[model samples]
Target: MKIINYREVPILRQSESPAAGKIWSAEGSISQRRHRQTRNGDIDMAVGDSLSMDEYKLTLASPAKVVPLDPNLVLPKPTPDIETAKADLKRAGYAILTDVFPEELVRTARQVLADEIKREEAIDESRVAKFFVDPDAKNRRLNRLPDRHEVFRQVLEHPVVLELTKHILGPTVLDESYLVHSVDANVTRPGSGAQFIHLDASNGVGHATPNQSRFIWCLDEFAEENGATRVVPGSHLWNPEIDPTGATTYESVPAEAPAGSLIIYTDMLLHGTGANISENRERASINFGITTPWCRPSINFPLVLDPEVMKNTSQTLRQLLGYSSVMNGGDYPWESAPESIRSLCVPAKMAY
Candidate 1:
């Protein structure tokens, strides 16, 4: 095992001077036995050893085909109560909670998304493009939602959603194990094609459980005619060996719900976007993902987030963004931390 010196972390260093944060790198491995372990019973520790990366390959699933849905399939329906929604999540691997957000809030979020998309288009038209599954170029994806606008950040902090996140991910010895994985928006325009069915959890190789969950905030009413999300109910509990490829045909039901509804699902669940067949109606949803703290988030919020937004955000939001997260037995510095945010520095006592 490789041992890292916590003091070597630049952000935790006492001095602000450039030299004080100097990083040490060596080509050869260093062992503590060379210096202090001339005496017996001293632990032989590898300090500067290079770690090797292991490759675990998978049998690639074949390309999926846009197939017709089985209308006879019965699945969980949307509910207004939290208990029922939670029950549905347990039973079907997904749940839809209606009226979770006020209609006005949904409207504001839609407007904000539109404005942000426009701004992004102006900056780089390539930023907005059709989903890979949408060959006709009807569907569009907007990435990094929280970094785009305050409305997205506000919606991402919904208490109910956070509660569900905690429920799904559970807690570690330190604190809540989950952190913000990513936030994005998916817009399915008319004639948009169906997406390939897949699992959100990349680690679902064999018996491994899901380490991630998602919150899909509806910006527009989802209907069968429009592009509602389609899911294979109870698929999360299915044996991992039963891999469904693009060529495979599986029964799926639309997770239809009204605007302002929230859809919760685990990464192990097999799901995809339904094709939009409506002439005028469009389907839009803001997708937020939360995963265990050990997982690398899609977006590096700490490195890329606007400083102004970071300065004014709430403690929960900061924690969710991984600001307070402990890595390799070290966390953010306490002494240099502002009084307003110091509570986040150490939620769990470090054993060392």
Candidate 2:
């Protein structure tokens, strides 16, 4: 595993480290991260901010051992292959699919997102479409990504991602009704502190498995310094109500990988983004979820993607984007109505 600083470990002796009785509470806001309240009461801090040797001196005092990553952070499992990837994902609640897309394609994908962000930001200075840039100016999640570029449409159905979705969710559960829950971008700007260490969903995880999973294609090389994703390995096995804060170390190992690699993880896994200490680097990634049909997706696909844009996209892309919800028994107004009747309704403001 590529660690940001092994040197922070040696700053304090085993006893001097403030490992015990340190309190962690979620205060201020969600993005600010839950701060670790040192026992002295004079000091308190959050994770995303660059840790000081003083904080390390205190944090290391906890029983959370600062050990080198074991079994590695990014799975070495070869992929575009199913069985190996499946095995790793099942075991760890996550897996890495290496070299699934070429480096150039991934580079262009990042560029496409960058352009979209710029264009969207210009339209509404306060709010950029679906993205709500955090107050810290560090992390921005670009929602409704499929609507932004045709290239993203290709990314949504990448072969390995599809296969894994099928394998994890299974044919019985899927029943040909799998849907794209959300297609978005996770851009960690320089100095963007680490994100809240939490699961995507708390239900059906740990005690039970979930139907939703994501394949986050790395659009930039993920390194410890540039805010690579952090994972607590197998925290998916904990009970549903188990608190992650004091129960486990938020001191996570960075799942460092190449730009074209995909980090596949279930919503259940305990994970968060590392702090980007770099002054001039951003960790770019595409969060594409292939999920079961039951839940209302993270974004209402049809509402966000206008018909004009859908016309130019491929049929597969169109379906994934919920254009074919009509085909999947989602037809409420009229089952077999003409296109006009299907999309339109009698005027609500009609006069006699």
Candidate 3:
């Protein structure tokens, strides 16, 4: 058996020998035999190894077992009531809740991002430059590229948000969605024009469907001068082909929510970020999506979470990422767990 450490592998205790205690190191790695003996008359064979000992006293330990420190971590306080938010969701395409997250969390997250940007900047300037400015001037709207930012993870798992999402999308709703892009002005250059008005799920495999929703969190203050997101309220009821201009007189309202405020909406809503005409300051917003089991996510979450992160994530988050099942859906498409869960389970099958 492959062992991560000596503790993981069983050891034979010297006192357990029924005959004259014969000390033979399985690998001769430990020179001290006295240290290897236990008070009980039994061999401490490493896990997966067999040893003759008092059946009652011998303990079996599996390295794979994980014990979490806190299983029921309460969610951070919410700024807006969930019922009110749900009501808004039905009335308008989106609803904004102000000051939902703790200010400290936002400040710390910003610091973490700034440090990461600085480090990445030192490594490659040109590569990081693309993260800020639009490649095509015509499509000048800043796109915040999301790739497992620490703050993003924190925001995604926040309890209040998750609870609200569950209430709106149904109890089975998971945080399958994540930040597709994070647009920041400091990184974005001037003349970054408005993005083409579009729906969040236009490219989604399940478009105009009932099982999807997006939850956008404003990490920084979003304002009219700083390229706040513009939206057409009640546009979710319209068909996809509807033109932006001729459409039911859209309103380009500034999404000026304070930091930690969240904007929850249906993916079908027509919205676009306004141009960042500001000279120095940049607007930063984190966009995350949540959906029912039947829909495909905007960003492939299972692919991004590394093994370590996956192991550390909450069961709720795992289910949200399509790592678990809801009842026995069998082998139907969208019925089974996502490919990420299949990959994680393969090693377990091999072990048996």
Which one is best on lDDT? 1
Per TM-score, what order, best first?
Answer: 1, 2, 3
Off by over 4 Å in 3: 1-79, 125-150, 171-190, 202-209, 244-251, 325-352
Please report, in order, the local distance difference test score of every candidate based on alpha carbons.
0.64, 0.59, 0.47
Ordering by lDDT: 1, 2, 3
**Residue 338 lDDT in candidate 2:** 53
Task: Identify the runs in model 1 with alpha carbons over 4 angstroms from their true place.
Answer: 1-74, 244-247, 332-352
Residue 115, candidate 2: C-alpha displacement in angstroms:
1.2
Better of 2 and 3 by lDDT: 2
lDDT of 3 at 232: 54
Model 1 scores what on Cα lDDT? 0.64
Q: Candidate 1, residues 1-352: lDDT per residue as tens digits?
A: 1111111001111224476675422222232212122133121111010121100011112223333333453467778988988888887889999877888889998998888777877897667775443433667789867667778888767788778877887765565435788888988889775654556664643645778878899999988778788777777777464343223335566788888999999887777777677999989999889887777877767666655556777767776776665554356465764565454343322211
In model 1, what lDDT does residue 84 have?
A: 89
**What's the alpha carbon RMSD for model 1?**
18.0
Model 2: residue 344 alpha-carbon error in angstroms = 12
Cα misplacement distance, residue 262 of candidate 2 (Å): 0.7
